[model samples]
Target: MSNATPPGWYPDASAPGTDRWWDGTAWTAHTRPAAQAPQAFGPPEPFTAASGDATTAARSGTRIAALAVAGLMVVGAAVTGAVLLGRDDDPARPEAGPSGSAPPSTTATATPSPDGSPAGNDPEVLVDQLNGITLPIPDGWEKPDRTVEPVPTMRTVDPYECPGSSSDFCYHATVTSRTASATDITSAEQLARQDITAAADRAYEKNIVGNRIHGGITSHDQLDSAPVSVAGRAGYQVRWRVNTAKGPGGYVQSLVFPSTVGSESLIIVRYAFDAGPDGPPLSLMDTLTKGIRPIGDSATSGGVGSSIAP
Candidate 1:
C-alpha cells in the first residue's frame, strides 16, 4: 500500500506537479504564474563581483579624505588648547594667595643710624660723660679745646657768627653761666629775647669773640619749641628770629644741662648771616652738643668749678 499524505500537504516544485510534500502545521509550498508572482513578489537579482583594482581605489580615496578632515580637526583643537594654556601661564595675571584677592607683599630696607661721635668717626658709646649733647660742626672740624675744665664743653674752630658787610653787627660766641636757682634763671621767653639782643649788641662789621655793641635791651618777640633731653634732664628747645643792623638774622642756641644742685647748663650759640640766606649749618651745633660730657670726677668733685669759658 502507498503511504498516505497528511492534511495541508502541497505539491513540491522540485518533485513536479503530481508529487506531494509534507507541510509542518501549514502549507509549505505553492506555485503561481510568472506575471502573478511578479505582482506580489520578485526574485532577487544576482550579485556580481567588482574588479579588485576599482574597489580598492574607491575605498582608498574615501579613507584618505576622511583622514585629512580628521587631521585638520585635531590640529585646530591642538592650536586652541595651546593658545588657552599660554594665556593662563602669562606672568601678568594676578597671583592667588591665602587671602583670596591679596597682592604679594614687598620688604623695605632699614635706614642706618647717624654717626654719634665728637669727630663723626667714632662709634657711639653710652658713657656718663656727656648726655643729650648735639653739635653741627662738619667732619674734622677743629676743636681748639677738647678738655673739660669746670664744665662739659665743646668749641668750634671758626667763629660761626660774623658781622655782615652792610651792618655794624659783629659775630661772636657768647658763653654765659649762672649758678642761680631755677627761679632766678630767666624764663625761656626772657632768655630768647635776651639772646637776640645779645646777638645784635655783639654784632660787628667783622666777627669777634666778645665785641660788645652799645644798645638798650630791646625785645624781638619770636619763639618756637623743640623737645630736648640733657644729662637725663628733660627740656624743650626754643628758637626764634630777630632783626639786626646787618639785616634779618637767624639764631639757634640751646641751654640744656642737668638741673641738679651741682648740675650746670651750657649754651652754645649759632648765628646765621641773614634771613633767606644759608646760615651756618646746625649740624655743627649737633656735633658739639653730642660731644658734651660731664667733667671728670676730679674736676666736679668739689662742685662744678668756675673755670667754664663762655
Candidate 2:
C-alpha cells in the first residue's frame, strides 16, 4: 500500500461481494457485504402484484412510493431495464423500474413562442428525431431547455427539491420520449410491459444517482396494460400506481411502439405524476396519449387506448 492511499473502503481482492476497509495503507480484515447496486441498476425480476386498487387513498398508506421523473423514471429510467410490480426487498437500494438510466436526447431549446412548442424550429412541437414522432406540449406544460438536462421531455412544473430527500429533485409531472432498442427483436407489448417497471423503479424508487426521491417505493399495482398505437403505428402500454413510503406517491406509465424512421427501432414514452389531490388528474395520461401525432402530420389521437380512472 502507498503512503497516501486515502483512508476509505475498497473492494477486497481476496473476497467477493464484500468491501474491505483501508485505514490508510494496509487493508483491514473487516469486511461487509458489497452494495447490491453500486452503479447502473441491474434488470430486476418482475415484481408481484400489490393488493389494492389504484386510488388517491392508496397514497395514504405507508407504502414506499418510487420509481421517477429518473424521476420517479424521470421517464428516462423507464426506457431502460428493471423489475416490475414486485416488492423491493432492499429499501436502501431501491429496485429498478424506471430503472436507472438515460439522459434525454439532445435538442434545440428555444423560448416558447406564442404557440408554445419547446423544441427545434417548431414553436408548437417537440420532435423526437430518434423515434420519428412528435409529442404535443399540452396546456400548462413546457418543453424544458435541452441544455438543462438531456431528456427530450415536457414538464408541468419546474424542477424542485424532493419533499422526502433534499439530495434529490422532482417534477410533479413529466413525460419523456425515447427509443428503447434498435437491435433487439421484440413485440411492442412485451417491451412496454418490461420497460414500465423500470421506469417506475428508476424514477420514484430512486433516481439514477440512487436517491429515493419519494421515500422509496414499497409496492405497485398494474393499473392498465393494453394494445394501442402511436403516431398511427402499432403500440402497447402499461401503467402502474407505484406506492411510496413518504410524500404523495405517484403514477407512472410506459408506452412502446416501433419508430417510423430508420430500421423501425422500438420507441418508448414514459409518464410520471404525483398521487393525491395536489397532483395532476390521471385523465391527463389519456389526454396526452391521444395527443401524440406524426411529425409534419396534422392528425392527433393515434388510436384507441386504455385510460387510468381517478
State the C-alpha lDDT per candidate.
Answer: 0.30, 0.59
Question: What TM-score goes with each of the models?
Answer: 0.32, 0.57
Question: Which residue ranges in model 2 land beyond 4 Å of their true spot?
Answer: 1-123, 147-149, 299-310
Model 1 agreement with the true structure over 40-142: per-residue lDDT tens digits: 1111111112332322321221111011122345744743222112222322221111111100111012111121122323212211221223322333222
**66-88: candidate 2 lDDT, tens digit per residue:** 44322145645544444334443
- On TM-score, the candidate that comes out on top is 2
Error of 2 at 25 (Å): 41
Against the true structure, candidate 1 has what lDDT?
0.30
